[model samples]
Target: MHDTSLYSSILGLSSQWHIANAVLDSKARSLRLDIAARSCAEFCCPVCGGAAVRVGADKGCWQHEDLLNMRFHISAVIPVTLCKTCGTNRISVPWERAGSCFRCMDNP
Candidate 1:
Protein backbone atom coordinates (compact mmCIF):
# COMPACT_ATOMS: atom_id res chain seq x y z
CA MET A 1 0.00 0.00 0.00
CA HIS A 2 1.08 3.58 -0.53
CA ASP A 3 2.11 5.80 2.37
CA THR A 4 -0.99 7.91 2.06
CA SER A 5 -3.19 4.86 2.01
CA LEU A 6 -1.52 3.53 5.11
CA TYR A 7 -1.95 6.80 6.93
CA SER A 8 -5.53 7.00 5.89
CA SER A 9 -6.23 3.53 7.18
CA ILE A 10 -4.68 4.34 10.52
CA LEU A 11 -6.62 7.56 10.77
CA GLY A 12 -9.81 5.81 9.86
CA LEU A 13 -9.30 3.09 12.42
CA SER A 14 -8.50 5.64 15.06
CA SER A 15 -11.59 7.67 14.34
CA GLN A 16 -13.77 4.57 14.27
CA TRP A 17 -12.45 3.69 17.71
CA HIS A 18 -13.21 7.20 18.99
CA ILE A 19 -9.55 8.08 19.19
CA ALA A 20 -8.80 11.76 19.69
CA ASN A 21 -6.37 13.91 17.75
CA ALA A 22 -3.40 12.05 16.25
CA VAL A 23 -0.70 14.65 15.99
CA LEU A 24 2.28 14.31 13.66
CA ASP A 25 5.24 16.28 14.93
CA SER A 26 8.95 16.21 13.97
CA LYS A 27 10.24 18.87 16.39
CA ALA A 28 10.84 16.38 19.15
CA ARG A 29 13.60 13.78 19.18
CA SER A 30 11.09 11.14 18.22
CA LEU A 31 10.32 11.07 14.54
CA ARG A 32 6.59 10.37 14.77
CA LEU A 33 4.30 10.32 17.78
CA ASP A 34 0.63 10.03 18.67
CA ILE A 35 -0.53 12.01 21.66
CA ALA A 36 -3.76 11.46 23.57
CA ALA A 37 -5.37 13.23 26.48
CA ARG A 38 -8.54 12.87 28.50
CA SER A 39 -10.39 14.98 31.05
CA CYS A 40 -12.32 14.20 34.20
CA ALA A 41 -15.66 14.65 32.48
CA GLU A 42 -14.82 12.03 29.89
CA PHE A 43 -14.43 9.31 32.42
CA CYS A 44 -17.43 6.99 32.62
CA CYS A 45 -17.67 4.19 35.10
CA PRO A 46 -17.85 0.72 33.56
CA VAL A 47 -20.71 -0.20 35.81
CA CYS A 48 -22.53 3.11 35.30
CA GLY A 49 -22.60 5.93 32.81
CA GLY A 50 -22.15 8.59 35.46
CA ALA A 51 -19.48 11.22 35.07
CA ALA A 52 -16.38 10.79 37.14
CA VAL A 53 -14.18 13.38 38.83
CA ARG A 54 -10.49 13.75 38.17
CA VAL A 55 -8.54 11.70 40.58
CA GLY A 56 -5.06 11.64 39.02
CA ALA A 57 -3.07 11.48 35.83
CA ASP A 58 -1.03 8.66 34.38
CA LYS A 59 1.84 9.51 32.06
CA GLY A 60 2.70 7.08 29.28
CA CYS A 61 4.40 6.85 25.90
CA TRP A 62 4.22 4.49 22.94
CA GLN A 63 6.32 4.03 19.82
CA HIS A 64 5.00 3.77 16.29
CA GLU A 65 6.18 4.18 12.71
CA ASP A 66 5.33 7.06 10.42
CA LEU A 67 4.71 7.22 6.68
CA LEU A 68 8.35 7.56 5.70
CA ASN A 69 9.85 4.84 7.84
CA MET A 70 10.18 7.42 10.60
CA ARG A 71 9.67 6.45 14.21
CA PHE A 72 6.81 8.06 16.11
CA HIS A 73 6.31 8.28 19.81
CA ILE A 74 2.86 8.50 21.32
CA SER A 75 2.62 10.31 24.60
CA ALA A 76 -0.51 10.28 26.66
CA VAL A 77 -1.81 11.77 29.85
CA ILE A 78 -4.46 9.32 30.98
CA PRO A 79 -6.94 10.54 33.54
CA VAL A 80 -8.24 8.52 36.46
CA THR A 81 -11.63 9.61 37.60
CA LEU A 82 -13.56 8.69 40.71
CA CYS A 83 -17.25 7.98 40.41
CA LYS A 84 -19.05 9.12 43.49
CA THR A 85 -22.15 7.05 42.88
CA CYS A 86 -20.33 3.82 42.11
CA GLY A 87 -17.38 4.62 44.35
CA THR A 88 -15.17 3.30 41.59
CA ASN A 89 -12.30 4.70 39.60
CA ARG A 90 -12.54 5.11 35.86
CA ILE A 91 -9.69 5.21 33.37
CA SER A 92 -10.14 7.22 30.21
CA VAL A 93 -7.92 7.72 27.20
CA PRO A 94 -8.16 10.35 24.54
CA TRP A 95 -6.73 8.11 21.85
CA GLU A 96 -7.60 4.67 20.57
CA ARG A 97 -6.54 1.37 22.06
CA ALA A 98 -3.15 1.52 23.78
CA GLY A 99 -1.58 -1.54 22.16
CA SER A 100 -2.50 -0.67 18.60
CA CYS A 101 0.73 -0.02 16.75
CA PHE A 102 -0.47 1.48 13.52
CA ARG A 103 2.94 1.39 11.93
CA CYS A 104 3.26 -2.30 12.43
CA MET A 105 -0.27 -3.02 11.38
CA ASP A 106 -0.06 -1.11 8.11
CA ASN A 107 2.35 -2.76 5.72
CA PRO A 108 3.20 -1.06 2.48
Candidate 2:
Protein backbone atom coordinates (compact mmCIF):
# COMPACT_ATOMS: atom_id res chain seq x y z
CA MET A 1 0.00 0.00 0.00
CA HIS A 2 1.10 3.59 -0.60
CA ASP A 3 1.67 5.58 2.57
CA THR A 4 3.51 8.76 3.42
CA SER A 5 2.41 8.93 7.06
CA LEU A 6 4.32 5.82 7.95
CA TYR A 7 7.51 7.19 6.46
CA SER A 8 6.81 10.62 7.87
CA SER A 9 6.46 9.19 11.34
CA ILE A 10 9.63 7.20 10.88
CA LEU A 11 11.41 10.38 9.84
CA GLY A 12 9.98 12.23 12.86
CA LEU A 13 9.11 15.09 10.58
CA SER A 14 7.75 18.26 12.09
CA SER A 15 4.11 19.25 11.65
CA GLN A 16 5.08 22.22 9.49
CA TRP A 17 6.03 20.03 6.56
CA HIS A 18 4.61 17.09 4.64
CA ILE A 19 5.67 14.68 1.94
CA ALA A 20 4.59 16.02 -1.41
CA ASN A 21 5.42 12.97 -3.48
CA ALA A 22 7.16 9.64 -3.35
CA VAL A 23 9.16 8.10 -6.16
CA LEU A 24 9.99 4.46 -6.08
CA ASP A 25 12.60 2.80 -8.23
CA SER A 26 11.99 -0.91 -7.95
CA LYS A 27 14.94 -1.77 -10.16
CA ALA A 28 17.30 0.29 -8.05
CA ARG A 29 15.44 -0.65 -4.86
CA SER A 30 15.21 2.95 -3.75
CA LEU A 31 12.67 5.50 -2.62
CA ARG A 32 12.76 9.27 -2.79
CA LEU A 33 10.36 11.72 -1.24
CA ASP A 34 9.72 15.33 -2.12
CA ILE A 35 8.67 17.44 0.85
CA ALA A 36 6.98 20.82 1.13
CA ALA A 37 6.59 23.26 3.98
CA ARG A 38 3.26 24.44 5.34
CA SER A 39 4.44 27.88 6.34
CA CYS A 40 7.64 29.92 5.97
CA ALA A 41 7.12 33.35 7.50
CA GLU A 42 6.92 31.87 11.00
CA PHE A 43 10.68 31.53 11.30
CA CYS A 44 13.27 34.22 12.04
CA CYS A 45 16.74 34.82 10.69
CA PRO A 46 19.71 33.10 12.33
CA VAL A 47 22.31 35.58 11.10
CA CYS A 48 20.37 38.58 12.35
CA GLY A 49 17.37 39.17 14.56
CA GLY A 50 15.26 40.40 11.70
CA ALA A 51 11.90 39.55 10.21
CA ALA A 52 12.26 37.31 7.18
CA VAL A 53 10.17 36.31 4.22
CA ARG A 54 10.11 32.93 2.51
CA VAL A 55 11.89 33.62 -0.77
CA GLY A 56 11.70 30.07 -2.20
CA ALA A 57 13.78 26.89 -1.94
CA ASP A 58 17.18 25.46 -2.76
CA LYS A 59 16.73 21.98 -4.18
CA GLY A 60 18.73 19.53 -2.12
CA CYS A 61 18.68 15.85 -1.35
CA TRP A 62 19.69 13.66 1.60
CA GLN A 63 20.09 9.91 1.76
CA HIS A 64 18.52 8.23 4.76
CA GLU A 65 18.22 4.78 6.31
CA ASP A 66 16.96 1.82 4.38
CA LEU A 67 13.70 -0.03 4.73
CA LEU A 68 14.67 -3.64 4.23
CA ASN A 69 16.46 -3.61 0.85
CA MET A 70 15.01 -0.32 -0.30
CA ARG A 71 17.04 2.83 0.29
CA PHE A 72 15.13 5.88 1.45
CA HIS A 73 15.90 9.50 0.62
CA ILE A 74 14.31 12.83 1.29
CA SER A 75 14.54 15.70 -1.18
CA ALA A 76 13.36 19.25 -1.09
CA VAL A 77 14.16 22.71 -2.19
CA ILE A 78 14.94 24.18 1.19
CA PRO A 79 12.96 27.28 1.97
CA VAL A 80 15.02 30.46 1.66
CA THR A 81 14.62 33.78 3.42
CA LEU A 82 15.10 37.38 2.51
CA CYS A 83 15.98 39.00 5.75
CA LYS A 84 15.99 42.75 6.05
CA THR A 85 19.41 42.76 7.70
CA CYS A 86 20.99 39.55 6.41
CA GLY A 87 19.89 40.08 2.81
CA THR A 88 19.22 36.54 1.45
CA ASN A 89 19.77 33.32 3.34
CA ARG A 90 18.74 29.68 3.24
CA ILE A 91 16.68 28.64 6.23
CA SER A 92 17.80 25.57 8.13
CA VAL A 93 15.81 22.37 8.02
CA PRO A 94 14.85 20.82 11.34
CA TRP A 95 16.24 17.41 10.40
CA GLU A 96 19.65 18.65 9.24
CA ARG A 97 22.71 19.56 11.25
CA ALA A 98 23.92 23.16 11.51
CA GLY A 99 25.91 24.03 8.34
CA SER A 100 25.96 20.42 7.22
CA CYS A 101 24.90 19.49 3.68
CA PHE A 102 23.19 16.19 4.66
CA ARG A 103 21.09 15.28 7.65
CA CYS A 104 22.51 15.20 11.16
CA MET A 105 22.72 11.40 11.19
CA ASP A 106 23.27 10.64 7.53
CA ASN A 107 26.83 10.42 6.18
CA PRO A 108 27.50 12.87 3.39
Candidate 3:
Protein backbone atom coordinates (compact mmCIF):
# COMPACT_ATOMS: atom_id res chain seq x y z
CA MET A 1 0.00 0.00 0.00
CA HIS A 2 1.22 3.46 -0.84
CA ASP A 3 1.48 6.24 1.70
CA THR A 4 -1.66 7.87 0.27
CA SER A 5 -3.67 4.81 1.29
CA LEU A 6 -2.52 5.44 4.81
CA TYR A 7 -4.14 8.87 4.61
CA SER A 8 -7.52 7.30 3.87
CA SER A 9 -7.36 5.29 7.07
CA ILE A 10 -5.89 8.16 9.05
CA LEU A 11 -8.73 10.37 7.91
CA GLY A 12 -11.26 7.73 9.00
CA LEU A 13 -12.57 7.26 5.48
CA SER A 14 -14.57 4.15 4.69
CA SER A 15 -14.32 1.80 1.72
CA GLN A 16 -16.88 3.97 -0.03
CA TRP A 17 -14.34 6.74 -0.33
CA HIS A 18 -11.17 6.88 -2.39
CA ILE A 19 -8.13 9.06 -2.33
CA ALA A 20 -7.72 10.09 -5.95
CA ASN A 21 -4.38 11.86 -5.58
CA ALA A 22 -1.85 13.33 -3.23
CA VAL A 23 0.44 16.32 -3.66
CA LEU A 24 3.25 17.60 -1.55
CA ASP A 25 4.71 21.05 -2.08
CA SER A 26 7.91 21.14 -0.12
CA LYS A 27 8.61 24.76 -0.94
CA ALA A 28 5.08 25.81 0.01
CA ARG A 29 5.15 23.46 2.94
CA SER A 30 1.72 22.06 2.10
CA LEU A 31 0.23 18.63 1.67
CA ARG A 32 -3.00 18.18 -0.24
CA LEU A 33 -5.16 15.10 -0.70
CA ASP A 34 -7.87 14.78 -3.27
CA ILE A 35 -10.76 12.52 -2.35
CA ALA A 36 -13.89 11.23 -3.97
CA ALA A 37 -16.73 8.83 -3.28
CA ARG A 38 -16.99 5.47 -4.99
CA SER A 39 -19.32 5.27 -7.96
CA CYS A 40 -21.68 2.83 -6.25
CA ALA A 41 -21.78 4.77 -3.04
CA GLU A 42 -25.06 6.22 -1.82
CA PHE A 43 -25.71 9.14 0.45
CA CYS A 44 -28.33 10.12 2.97
CA CYS A 45 -30.31 13.32 3.07
CA PRO A 46 -28.62 15.72 5.42
CA VAL A 47 -31.97 17.07 6.53
CA CYS A 48 -34.34 14.12 6.45
CA GLY A 49 -31.88 11.25 6.84
CA GLY A 50 -33.36 9.43 3.84
CA ALA A 51 -31.68 7.72 0.92
CA ALA A 52 -30.64 10.07 -1.88
CA VAL A 53 -29.25 9.90 -5.37
CA ARG A 54 -26.28 11.94 -6.52
CA VAL A 55 -27.34 14.66 -8.90
CA GLY A 56 -24.12 16.67 -9.18
CA ALA A 57 -20.80 17.40 -7.60
CA ASP A 58 -18.87 20.48 -6.64
CA LYS A 59 -15.20 21.02 -5.95
CA GLY A 60 -14.42 21.87 -2.37
CA CYS A 61 -11.23 22.64 -0.48
CA TRP A 62 -10.73 22.55 3.25
CA GLN A 63 -7.86 23.39 5.56
CA HIS A 64 -6.57 21.01 8.15
CA GLU A 65 -3.90 21.23 10.79
CA ASP A 66 -0.32 21.10 9.62
CA LEU A 67 1.29 17.71 9.23
CA LEU A 68 5.02 17.43 9.90
CA ASN A 69 5.21 21.23 9.79
CA MET A 70 3.56 21.35 6.37
CA ARG A 71 0.16 22.92 5.83
CA PHE A 72 -2.44 20.22 5.21
CA HIS A 73 -5.44 20.59 2.93
CA ILE A 74 -8.20 18.36 1.71
CA SER A 75 -9.63 18.86 -1.76
CA ALA A 76 -12.68 16.83 -2.62
CA VAL A 77 -15.43 16.42 -5.14
CA ILE A 78 -18.46 16.94 -2.98
CA PRO A 79 -21.54 15.14 -4.18
CA VAL A 80 -24.88 16.87 -4.35
CA THR A 81 -27.72 14.50 -3.63
CA LEU A 82 -31.37 14.81 -4.54
CA CYS A 83 -33.70 13.69 -1.81
CA LYS A 84 -37.40 13.20 -2.42
CA THR A 85 -38.30 15.03 0.74
CA CYS A 86 -35.63 17.71 0.93
CA GLY A 87 -34.64 18.43 -2.65
CA THR A 88 -30.91 18.82 -3.31
CA ASN A 89 -28.20 18.94 -0.70
CA ARG A 90 -24.42 18.58 -0.58
CA ILE A 91 -23.29 15.41 1.15
CA SER A 92 -20.86 15.88 3.97
CA VAL A 93 -17.41 14.32 3.89
CA PRO A 94 -16.48 11.91 6.67
CA TRP A 95 -13.66 14.16 7.85
CA GLU A 96 -15.74 17.32 7.99
CA ARG A 97 -18.82 18.71 9.63
CA ALA A 98 -21.93 19.95 7.88
CA GLY A 99 -21.62 23.58 6.73
CA SER A 100 -18.00 23.76 7.80
CA CYS A 101 -14.82 24.18 5.77
CA PHE A 102 -12.57 22.46 8.34
CA ARG A 103 -12.00 18.90 9.49
CA CYS A 104 -13.36 17.67 12.80
CA MET A 105 -11.11 15.28 14.65
CA ASP A 106 -13.40 14.77 17.64
CA ASN A 107 -17.08 15.08 18.41
CA PRO A 108 -17.98 18.60 19.41
Candidate 4:
Protein backbone atom coordinates (compact mmCIF):
# COMPACT_ATOMS: atom_id res chain seq x y z
CA MET A 1 0.00 0.00 0.00
CA HIS A 2 1.14 3.51 -0.80
CA ASP A 3 1.42 6.08 1.93
CA THR A 4 -0.75 9.10 1.30
CA SER A 5 1.28 11.17 3.73
CA LEU A 6 4.40 10.78 1.64
CA TYR A 7 2.54 11.68 -1.51
CA SER A 8 0.96 14.68 0.17
CA SER A 9 4.31 15.92 1.39
CA ILE A 10 5.83 15.59 -2.05
CA LEU A 11 2.92 17.42 -3.62
CA GLY A 12 3.09 20.16 -1.03
CA LEU A 13 6.77 20.69 -1.59
CA SER A 14 6.32 20.80 -5.34
CA SER A 15 3.53 23.34 -4.95
CA GLN A 16 5.86 25.73 -3.14
CA TRP A 17 7.93 25.93 -6.30
CA HIS A 18 7.07 26.37 -9.96
CA ILE A 19 6.94 22.64 -10.45
CA ALA A 20 5.08 21.24 -13.41
CA ASN A 21 4.66 17.71 -12.12
CA ALA A 22 6.03 15.15 -9.68
CA VAL A 23 5.77 11.43 -10.27
CA LEU A 24 6.70 8.44 -8.19
CA ASP A 25 7.65 5.41 -10.27
CA SER A 26 7.54 2.31 -8.20
CA LYS A 27 8.89 0.12 -10.98
CA ALA A 28 11.87 2.38 -11.58
CA ARG A 29 12.11 3.24 -7.90
CA SER A 30 12.51 6.87 -8.73
CA LEU A 31 10.68 10.16 -8.45
CA ARG A 32 10.71 12.01 -11.75
CA LEU A 33 9.86 15.68 -11.51
CA ASP A 34 10.12 18.92 -13.37
CA ILE A 35 9.68 22.62 -12.75
CA ALA A 36 8.01 25.13 -15.05
CA ALA A 37 8.89 28.80 -14.99
CA ARG A 38 10.14 31.58 -17.17
CA SER A 39 13.26 30.70 -19.08
CA CYS A 40 15.45 33.62 -17.96
CA ALA A 41 13.72 36.80 -17.03
CA GLU A 42 11.47 35.63 -14.22
CA PHE A 43 13.72 32.94 -12.83
CA CYS A 44 15.70 33.91 -9.76
CA CYS A 45 19.23 32.81 -8.97
CA PRO A 46 19.29 29.90 -6.57
CA VAL A 47 22.55 30.91 -4.98
CA CYS A 48 22.01 34.64 -4.84
CA GLY A 49 18.89 36.75 -5.25
CA GLY A 50 19.84 38.06 -8.64
CA ALA A 51 18.60 37.91 -12.20
CA ALA A 52 19.55 34.69 -13.99
CA VAL A 53 20.11 33.70 -17.58
CA ARG A 54 19.72 30.31 -19.13
CA VAL A 55 23.30 29.27 -19.61
CA GLY A 56 23.12 25.47 -19.58
CA ALA A 57 21.21 22.47 -18.31
CA ASP A 58 21.86 19.82 -15.67
CA LYS A 59 20.26 17.01 -13.70
CA GLY A 60 20.44 16.02 -10.04
CA CYS A 61 19.70 12.75 -8.31
CA TRP A 62 19.13 12.07 -4.64
CA GLN A 63 18.02 9.25 -2.40
CA HIS A 64 14.77 9.51 -0.45
CA GLU A 65 12.44 7.25 1.46
CA ASP A 66 9.02 5.91 0.56
CA LEU A 67 6.28 4.24 2.55
CA LEU A 68 7.40 1.79 5.23
CA ASN A 69 11.11 1.07 4.93
CA MET A 70 11.35 1.28 1.21
CA ARG A 71 13.96 3.49 -0.30
CA PHE A 72 13.33 5.61 -3.36
CA HIS A 73 15.52 7.62 -5.68
CA ILE A 74 14.64 11.07 -6.95
CA SER A 75 15.85 12.62 -10.20
CA ALA A 76 15.23 16.16 -11.31
CA VAL A 77 16.07 17.76 -14.65
CA ILE A 78 16.92 21.13 -13.19
CA PRO A 79 17.93 24.05 -15.29
CA VAL A 80 21.38 25.55 -14.87
CA THR A 81 20.83 29.25 -14.75
CA LEU A 82 23.81 31.54 -14.48
CA CYS A 83 23.61 34.86 -12.75
CA LYS A 84 25.36 37.40 -14.92
CA THR A 85 25.53 39.91 -12.10
CA CYS A 86 26.81 37.51 -9.46
CA GLY A 87 28.53 35.04 -11.81
CA THR A 88 26.99 32.11 -9.99
CA ASN A 89 25.17 29.06 -11.32
CA ARG A 90 21.83 28.37 -9.70
CA ILE A 91 19.51 25.37 -9.54
CA SER A 92 16.06 25.69 -8.05
CA VAL A 93 14.56 23.07 -5.79
CA PRO A 94 13.02 22.77 -2.35
CA TRP A 95 15.92 21.17 -0.61
CA GLU A 96 15.22 20.56 3.06
CA ARG A 97 18.84 20.62 4.05
CA ALA A 98 22.30 20.56 2.58
CA GLY A 99 23.55 17.02 1.94
CA SER A 100 20.32 15.72 3.45
CA CYS A 101 17.75 13.51 1.77
CA PHE A 102 14.11 14.60 1.87
CA ARG A 103 12.87 11.35 3.29
CA CYS A 104 15.52 10.91 5.91
CA MET A 105 14.46 11.88 9.41
CA ASP A 106 17.95 11.78 10.84
CA ASN A 107 19.64 15.02 11.71
CA PRO A 108 22.97 15.61 10.08
Identify the leading candidate in terms of lDDT.
3
lDDT per model vs. reference:
0.49, 0.72, 0.79, 0.54
lDDT for predicted candidate 2 compared with the true structure: 0.72
Deviation (Å) of 50 in candidate 2: 4.7
**Please, what are the lDDT tens digits per residue for candidate 2 over residues 1-108?**
378897777666777678889988899999988887775335567578588888777777787555656877788767788898888888777657554333533335
Tens-place lDDT digits, model 4, residues 1-108 = 333445446545443344445666667666644544334435568777777777776666555665335465444555677787677574655654555456422323
Worst 10 residues of 2 by lDDT: 99-108
Residue-by-residue lDDT tens digits, candidate 1, 31-83:
44333432324556645778766677666665565435566654555566678
Q: Which ten residues in a row have the lowest lDDT in candidate 3?
A: 99-108
How high a TM-score does candidate 4 get?
0.53
Q: What is the Cα-based lDDT of residue 80 in candidate 1?
A: 60
Candidate 1 lDDT:
0.49
Q: How high is the lDDT of residue 33 in model 1?
A: 38
User: Which regions of candidate 4 are displaced past 4 Å?
Assistant: 1-8, 11-41, 65-68, 96-99, 102-108
Q: Count the backbone clashes (under 3 Å) in each candidate.
A: 4, 0, 0, 0
